[model samples]
Target chain A: MKVHVIGIGLIGGSMVLDIKSLHPDATIYGIDTNESHLAEAITLGVIDKVGTFDDLAEADFVIVSVPVDVALTLMPKVLDAIGDNTIVFEVGSTKIPICEAVANHQRRRNFIATHPIAGTEFSGPSAAIKNLFQGKTNIICEVEKTTFKLQEKALDLFRSLGMRIRYMDPKSHDKHIAYVSHLSHISSFMLGKTVINKEKDEQDIFDMAGSGFESTVRLAKSSPAMWTPIFKQNKKQVVKSLEEYISNLTLFKELLANDDFDAIFNEMQSVNKIKEILNGMKK
Target chain B: MKVHVIGIGLIGGSMVLDIKSLHPDATIYGIDTNESHLAEAITLGVIDKVGTFDDLAEADFVIVSVPVDVALTLMPKVLDAIGDNTIVFEVGSTKIPICEAVANHQRRRNFIATHPIAGTEFSGPSAAIKNLFQGKTNIICEVEKTTFKLQEKALDLFRSLGMRIRYMDPKSHDKHIAYVSHLSHISSFMLGKTVINKEKDEQDIFDMAGSGFESTVRLAKSSPAMWTPIFKQNKKQVVKSLEEYISNLTLFKELLANDDFDAIFNEMQSVNKIKEILNGMKK
Candidate 1:
């Protein structure tokens, strides 16, 4: 099998690492506008060779794993470049924009929209690791738009990566992800910014941060190059989520300021239900 | 050596799990007001025997591991009851109030103000595990107030738990921790509350939450009984930290509303330094 992968960064590079194990005979072509990332992906043995969009026609599968904005622009072009039977898919965080971008394309039936809900805070080709997608949920949005043959093939590939597939409309996927994923990144970034802004003594932050702080602020270390586009692409849903998050924080602040320890304690207890919710998610 | 451990829950129980190896000959007595906890601790073999505050006089070491409010109320009493040369210490999240509460006590020299910067989201004796403090930081505040002999013994105990000790003024410890540890719990709780409030569909939250959301909101699963008193005791510093966090979120919200991608991107990149800060803390 010949596979063409766009944007040799975390998602794409990780896919290369895991998928190559399942298809050792597969020839993978790495494509990235960032020449350095393409080279690094090769050096990391995440892909077999360097190629371009021009090579899409000969590929059995084409995966776009670039920033959402770049994916939005590249989706239509990729569909135009790929052969009739070749399957194309993207693993972008925000699905709506990209799905809408290629909705009317003549070759739309060949393209699948996916959001693999797995990643570490780290980024780049060096950050890629095998089994990154194992036991993780993969949201496949607007699957009905894709041809049955390609959808089956994509599902097989996702299964091979040990990902459980969930189908949803692009709109629902974006909105729900705004709360569960995007909002989390925003909250962590803001927390890191708030603490960094207040505690100018870096050593103090270094010394005082415990496991809780480390876990809570871990997403703040994520690449801005990737998240900025995702936030922008899903701005409407993200903004709504942020407004609610800000309102909740304000209420919590008032509870603290009022010395209403009971309310604060109850509020925390109420949210403690997230443990069960997270457990369900893991399953 | 005879040791009396107050509040045989997560911290104290974990201490028993780890420190037992280093001081196998030590006669450890569990002291908790909660009857069930005392029974469970004894049943779990976390302590050799169950004791009470009255046992303080016989203890070569008195480790108070209760909520900060309880610790503050008990620190003076514990100090009064312990004999000279008995190294008394409490591992409360907040340090200033407990330190100040016993500052002028006749036995203050025997009490060491320490906050072991370690814990899981879970609570109780059932949640306790061995080596929870391995390679974690243990902040010892107001070291000058404790006698040098007690300080060395406390350090040795903390080191035996595989902790690195950092000394600071109680005021500094409380303030810095308000941003790093306490603020993280608040942010996580508020994040969980916000998502729970908005998503209304609990199933949606469970289905959509990824690893990032789980990590960012993990502290929301923490025990309210343990956290409430810490927040109440460190109210000033916590409120200050929460205000800053809320302000940062509000500002980020506005940036999203205004499509100020550059500002948001720059803010995230700046906070990205936390990766290095956290790495240093780990080492």
Candidate 2:
């Protein structure tokens, strides 16, 4: 099987590496608009051969893993260029727009909308890893939109990469992702902004930052080009989640201001249930 | 020199282990209000022996690592019990209260009020590790209150543990930490609550939680008992930080609602400076 990955950045590059490692005999090609990233991906050996959209006709599968806005604009064009036997899939954070963009395409059935629900704060081809998707959840939205054979092929591909897959509607996927993923990026970014804004002396921030600050602010380091669109695409749900998050923080603040020790303790106790939920999710 | 660690939970137990490993000949004693933690500390060999508060007077150095509230309450009493030759220090998140509480004590100068800005989401003695403080910032607040000899002892111990010491005022320390440390915990807890509350079906969260969510919400798994007092003590700064955070989220939400892609992208791009700040801090 020949696999061609577009936008060979973190997610796309890691996918290529993972696939190559799992199936050594499989031929993999890569494409990216960024010359540096293409060079880096090629140097890293993330792809067997670096190709362009012109070569899409010969590929058995084409994976679009670009920024959300780019994915929306280029997905259909990639679909149009692919052969009927070729399966096209996307690994984007937001799904509604991407799903809608290709819903009416003649080869819509050849496309599958998937979000592997995995990533780190880093980006670019250098950030790619062979087992980036291991033991992680992969959310496949509107899977029925794809042909049965293509769906099976995609499933086998994800399984080989050691991912657990789940199905959901595009709308629901957007909403839940806003709460779990998009809002996290915003929270982290804003927290980082707030701290940087408050601490005029950068040296103070450097001297005072511990692991807590590092972990909490890790996602703030994510690529703005990628996340800015995600926040825009799923604005409503992201806003709602952000509002609830803000309200919760405000109430905790009020309790603190009142010096209501019991209230503060009780609130923390209530939220501590997060441990149980997180543990359950791990299982 | 002999050392006695009070409340051998994560911070204390880890301190004991690190101190022991650094100075193998140093006889270490563990003291805790929780019997189970005491036993676990002993079994983990975090200490040479388990003892009571009475053992504090016999040690050359006494380390108090407990919850902020408990530390504030017990520190003065412990200082009263310790001899002038013994050096006493604390590793708590907040420093103002403890400093104020022990200000007028006769042996106030014998006590070093320090906040080592290091910890993990896990708690209890079992969470202890050998080099928890290595290369981490150990902020010594209001050193004026500590005697020169005792301060030297504290500095020597921390230096031996491979920590770089930073000096700051207690009030400033509390305020800065409120933004950098305390607020992160609240943001995480509330983020966890919002997701767990919104996603009624636990299975959904379990299915969708990626590394992004896990890293963002990791602090939510922290012990409420440990965090409640931190929010209480650092109430003012937390409230201010919380308000700013809410306003930022609301503004982002409004931008999203308007589908103002330019505005959204610009804001995210501006906030992307966090990457530079975090990277600088990591170095």
Candidate 3:
């Protein structure tokens, strides 16, 4: 099998590595507009060859792994370029836009919209790793639009990479991902901005940042180019989640101001239910 | 030398283990309001023995590691029970209240208000690990309050455990920590609450929680008993930091609602400065 991965950065590059590692006979082609990333991906041996758009015509599988905005624009082009028998899939955070963009394409049945719920804060081709999708969930949206053979191919590919797959509607996937993923990036970036703006002394922040701060602010280090588009594409749901998040923080502030120790403590306890939720996520 | 550690949970127990590991001949005594933690500390070999308030008189060094509210109240009692030559210190997140609570104590000169900014969300004796303080900063506030000899003792002990030290005023310490540490906890808890409330199907949350959400929400798993007191004692500063945080989120919401993509994208780019800040912290 031959797989063409476009915009080979963290997610795409890592997927290339995973596919190559799992299917040694499968040939992998990398595509990226960023010359430096292509160079790094080639140097890192993340792909068997760095190829151009022409490669998509012959690709058994074409994976769109770019910024959400670019994914929306480029996905249709890739779909138009691919053969009817070729399977095209996207690993974008927001599914609705990408799904809609390709909804009317003649080869729409050849496309599968998937988001493998896995990533590190780091970006670029150099950040890619083998088995990045192992033990993680890959959400497949609007599976009915995908041809049975292509869906089977995508499932086999994810399964071979050791990922569990779940199905959801594209709209529902966008809403759920906003709360679970997109909002997290915003909260982290804003928290980082808040602290950096207030604590001008870099040395003070260094001295005082514990693991709690590190973990909470980890997403702040994510690439702005990658996240900004996600936030924009999922704006409505992201806005809703952000409002509720702000409301929650404001409620906490009021509780603190009133010295309502019981309320403060109980609210934290309620939120602490996240422990069970996180533990569940681990499984 | 004899050292008594109060509240032998994650931070306290880890400190005991590190101290004992470094000073093989030092006899360490454990104390906690929770009997189970005290017993677990001993069974885990984190301390040489278990003791009560009476043990302070004989302790060459006394380390208070209880919750902030309890630390403020219990510190004075420990001071009253300790010898004039005893070197006392604490590892609370907030320092102003503890510093103020013991400001005029007769043995104030023997006390050192310190915050070792390191810990995981998990707590209790089982969470203790060796070398917790290695390569971490131990922030000592109001060092002038400590007698020269006791200061030397505390400095030497922290050095022995592979920790670097920085000195700051308690007021600045609490305010800075409120932004860097306290605000992070609230953000994490609220993020967890927002997601959990929005995603009623636990399976969706479990499947969709990528590393981004997991890292951002990790601190929500922290103990309420431990965090509640810190929030109560540092209420004012926490409220201020939280207000700034909510304001930032609100502004971002407006930008998103307006479809000001450039504004949204640029804000994230600016906030991406956190990557540099976090890189500096790692150094």
Candidate lDDT values, in order: 0.88, 0.84, 0.88
**Candidate 1: Cα lDDT at A20:** 88
Off by over 4 Å in 3: none
lDDT of 3 by residue, A144-203 (tens): 989999899889989988999999998989988889888999999899889989988877
lDDT of 1: 0.88
DockQ of each: 0.85, 0.72, 0.86
Clashing pairs in 3: none
lDDT of 1 by residue, B1-283 (tens): 8888888888888887777777889888988888998888888888889887777887888888998888877888888888877999899898878888998899889988888888888877777789999998889888888899988888988898899889888888888999989989988998898889878989888767878999999999999998999898888999888888888888898998899999989999999999899889877
The backbone clash count of each candidate, in order, is 0, 1, 0
Give interface RMSD for all predictions: 1.0, 1.6, 0.9
Q: Which docking class does model 3 fall in?
A: high
Error of 2 at A214 (Å): 1.0
- Residues B1-283, candidate 2, lDDT per residue (tens digit)? 7899988888888887888888889998888888888788778898788866777777788989888889888988898788769999888888889888888989888888888878899898889987888888899988877878878888998999888899999989988888788878888888887887798887888888877788888898888888887777777788888887777777777877788878877776776776777777556
Report the lDDT of model 2 for residue A117.
Answer: 83
